[model samples]
Target chain A: MKTDEKTRAPVARIPDADVPGTVERMRKGERRAIASVITELERLSAAAPALLRSLQPHLGHALVVGFTGPPGAGKSTLVNAIIAQLRQQGRTVGVIAVDPSSPVSGGAILGDRIRMTAALDDDGVFVRSLASRGYLGGLSPAAVRIIDALDGAGYDVVLLETVGTGQNEIDVAEVADIRVVIAAPGLGDDIQAMKSGLLEIADVIVVNKADRPGAEQTLQQLVGALSIRATMSDKVPVLKTSAINGEGVPKLIETLDQLGGKVRAEDAVSRRRRRARYLIARAASDIVANRIKAGSKGGLDTLADSVLSGTMSPHAAATRLLED
Target chain B: MKTDEKTRAPVARIPDADVPGTVERMRKGERRAIASVITELERLSAAAPALLRSLQPHLGHALVVGFTGPPGAGKSTLVNAIIAQLRQQGRTVGVIAVDPSSPVSGGAILGDRIRMTAALDDDGVFVRSLASRGYLGGLSPAAVRIIDALDGAGYDVVLLETVGTGQNEIDVAEVADIRVVIAAPGLGDDIQAMKSGLLEIADVIVVNKADRPGAEQTLQQLVGALSIRATMSDKVPVLKTSAINGEGVPKLIETLDQLGGKVRAEDAVSRRRRRARYLIARAASDIVANRIKAGSKGGLDTLADSVLSGTMSPHAAATRLLED
Candidate 1:
């Protein structure tokens, strides 16, 4: 297990602002402090930049493993099983469960939390459920910051479970070091998996609920589909696991361990580079969105009026915005 | 039906570029000319801006209706029925079906095309299947341009059917004058629809495949959900349809026509303004993405290296890039 040297540092007291103290508490693995930072970042407050900057040196220690699939594909159950196995091995884990928050029924996140209560009592495990706030496709904008906070707090592994429904949820690919795509049998899950385009981004394919009928067929279908892309440099492994009974959980963990080490050794720099690029793009987009929302002079409303009145084409209007 | 007077004007022959000629041909309702323009726009060619500029005066005729739901919810079947109903009323229709492109399988789009073959032989109807090109949510960047072309060519209605799996697919809400969310029985589709947050954006809720076993229950569930949200100013209608046998499709079409007319009468300016804003935002994001990809001086790589090496924070790096 990789440990941060800063984990042993003493909690410091800071005057005027509680951010530094919070950072210190977070570095010492205080769950409350970590939760506070995540909430602040989600709110996108002015203090967030300072809090994140203070936590920077302590980041990049945790291995982020993303588990994604269709909603009913047993991803939470699989995640719960994996957490149990990781806890058994004496590894600290932080989980970020990204759930789609609906305007009507907003209780699905609560259901997810209830389903993953296996590790709630264990100090080595910390789980946080995040509502996507309708951002869609794996993680919310606040997810990157939350992951950084968890990583800085010295978790050996950070598990990100996202409900993959459409192609946009592939945002997990940018955040996770290892991407696992899960599927179940008899739900037309094989087709659903293909439609979501999760197969392309998966580093590991897991056929969960493997004890169910048609499990073998689904696994074979995935293997066949993946084989067509075998010309690619990396050959992603497809494994089967009955997460409910803990069957194949050990092997899954072993595979993850091996893949994790190999990735860190071979492509860590490129992975970090990719993540940095994603972060930069996201930040730039957020800035543009804010500018448009704030209705700065020559911003969206002005351009929109021009387009609406037929004074300018939308493409031309867009080009003007880009130039601005 | 709304018609642009600009469509009756003589074809202006420009000396340098034949784009005006193509636009002239498209405005005369030539299917080949429309297809060519759509292709050029999808390619994002140098001539696309000129082509779109020429078509602008002839635009804003078609009522763009967005139909979205989870995959296998029979969205295509519903769309086909809707198209047939529109054609029976002597209205020309254009359909854009957005399918998630899988790098491995790449067959979903083909399946969609096959499913909607009912209107393929009809000159009054045109259908195009667009690969999302991994661009999640809304229509592809090219889709906006295509819709404009179709509108300019004098299609009475342009139907956009998107597979809504995740929340981000709500991009359709921005583009469509009327947003219809479809759900089918016995797939936990009620829950799935709720999770995708489509209820918030929907102008019409469709329970497709209404002849299925649990159809009444699903319909009731949707009604219950919508009733809870009845406090909102816009009371979205929940309707049942068996698209397979054309049951209730006419009522759905009538509802769409009423809603479309109502929205256009009430908020047409704001709707166009919103679309312009979306176009501008998309254009700006594309520019930033291209800049990052091109590796401009002091761009992503330099900042990424700093972030990777722990010299700068991801948030700070992102902020710097935004300022640049």
Candidate 2:
């Protein structure tokens, strides 16, 4: 389902007054343009839609990989190692680390950005930290748009790292081409993975900090748990890595490359279709919610008062709002 | 503003043909009717709207208390102890335990239900477990509706227990009139409460398992942390309770009663108004999302394919759908 060169040709000369120039600059790998576009998208500025439309033709070139696990799992260290490996292969990378719990000025965001110093100095790598502006999921609502911009800006791979603690965090699986679920020894009992609902969505399970005493036991437990589920066409591999000592990172990278290749070769169309559907649906919901909020105009407060005073039911009030 | 008796007169005889009979049965404390209505609401049945409209007059009578904390914080045990205390005071209680990760038939649900055997055996207690149904938060989308139904069904108190693992789970604060944030000794480092985003929303902080060695340190840490935040009119209390042996349970109950009383006596109308607004807003979002899903026939699929094949951007696709 790849677009033919003829179809791609039209995008090279997009005439949109708000976007064409910036898109051209971004496509030339202009870092400032890329950053500005991302900032606009993050702020949901009026020009974001036009910019995204202009950049559409150049998107879909980057492989988006998602890393999710419980906090304190050494995901940052592992991500740094992976970035180093990808850099060695001459691949440009972009990273979005999502913190759901942090406020806008929270130190956690600064800490995460500082910890990625290994990639900060490299021109081939870019890193950003996104805090939820009261959004439920760890990732910002504009994450998909930013990822698209990164893809269009000639990044070869985009890494998404989120704290896997709630059902909303599981949404990362829908956005990424390859989903890695990281676990650490002694985090909790074996049932922790199952309880967090991570085992089901994991494309690859990495037992990080494998030098710890319980690492082998945890690995076996995860493997055993994975086997009990009905096997899928692609068997999910449980790998061990010690991010502290950099052991087994190369193997993990190789596995990721092979898996990414297989996915691109075999199921890219279907996967992209699914991701597109999810993104559109989510965007539609956000639009509708915003519209409702904008239109309420003290009407919601009156209706709420009526419900509280027992003159109208919450359902009836909601129905009335929807009707309006 | 509290409605006068004259204003409440008409509600005594809601003439809605679809819901009068069931509402009557539920108001009479018929357990079967209450259970059936809740099940219908959970399933989002067609009759739910009518039922809720009829039940509206009887709603706003229950005190909704929310208990949330990290996993393994002994929240269930504390809730169980609270239920016993409330029951001893001759108050009927309704319990909703939310598990975000559980599948429909997951053992966690069963395990939670089993743990509440003490309450299940009593006629004064009605217990229900809600799985996320892939909802982002542990709470079911129908949770507010179910709570209203319970309130209408003559329950004096409604208890909502959820795992505080992500930002979405914080939605419990909207639904509950009084929120209890639980922590336990040796759960993790002192920063655990802050990381979970529990400290900001806690109306009451309970240090469960207070018999542990580090309980004093944890309690002092929590107190110190709480001191840093600007104080409100009513200082949020930090209580210590060892739910294992029932120590501190009575005092906890006393504190709850006093707080609940204060809330009801001082700001019941405002609180109910706020809750109603939240419910209506959430309901509107759900309704709009559902309408979008229902309205998009093969149109969405086509748009998604276009986005995937790079013929259109996701933002453009979403805009098209919203316009339609």
As a whole number from 0 to 100, the lDDT of residue A285 in candidate 1 is 60
Error of 1 at B69 (Å): 2.6
Q: Across residues A1-324, which tens digit of lDDT does each residue of candidate 1 receive?
A: 222244321222222288888888887877788777777665545455567678767766788998876655778788989988888899989988766644455646445464557355666878776766543333455677677778878889999876535433567766789988887787552244343456657788899999999999888877777677756325788899999899999999899998888777755456656776776665566566556645664467887765544345555776677676
Per-model TM against the reference: 0.73, 0.66
- What lDDT score belongs to each candidate, Candidate 1 first? 0.69, 0.68
| Candidate 2 CA-lDDT value | 0.68
True contacts kept of each: 0.36, 0.31
True contacts kept of 2: 0.31
Q: What DockQ results for candidate 2?
A: 0.22
Task: Give the range where candidate 1 chain B is weakest over 10 consecutive residues by summed lDDT.
Answer: B7-16
Distance (Å) between predicted and true CA of A301, model 1? 11
lDDT of 1 at B258: 84
Per-residue CA lDDT of model 2 for A1-324, tens digit only, reads: 222254332232223474778878888877777888787666555455577667767766788899976555677778888888789889999988665545523545445454655454677887776664333433454677678778878899999876435433556766788999888887552234233456656788999989998989888767755656656424888899998788888898888888888777754445556676776666665565566555655887798766544455555777898677
Clash statistics: count for each candidate: 1, 0
Clashing pairs in 2: none
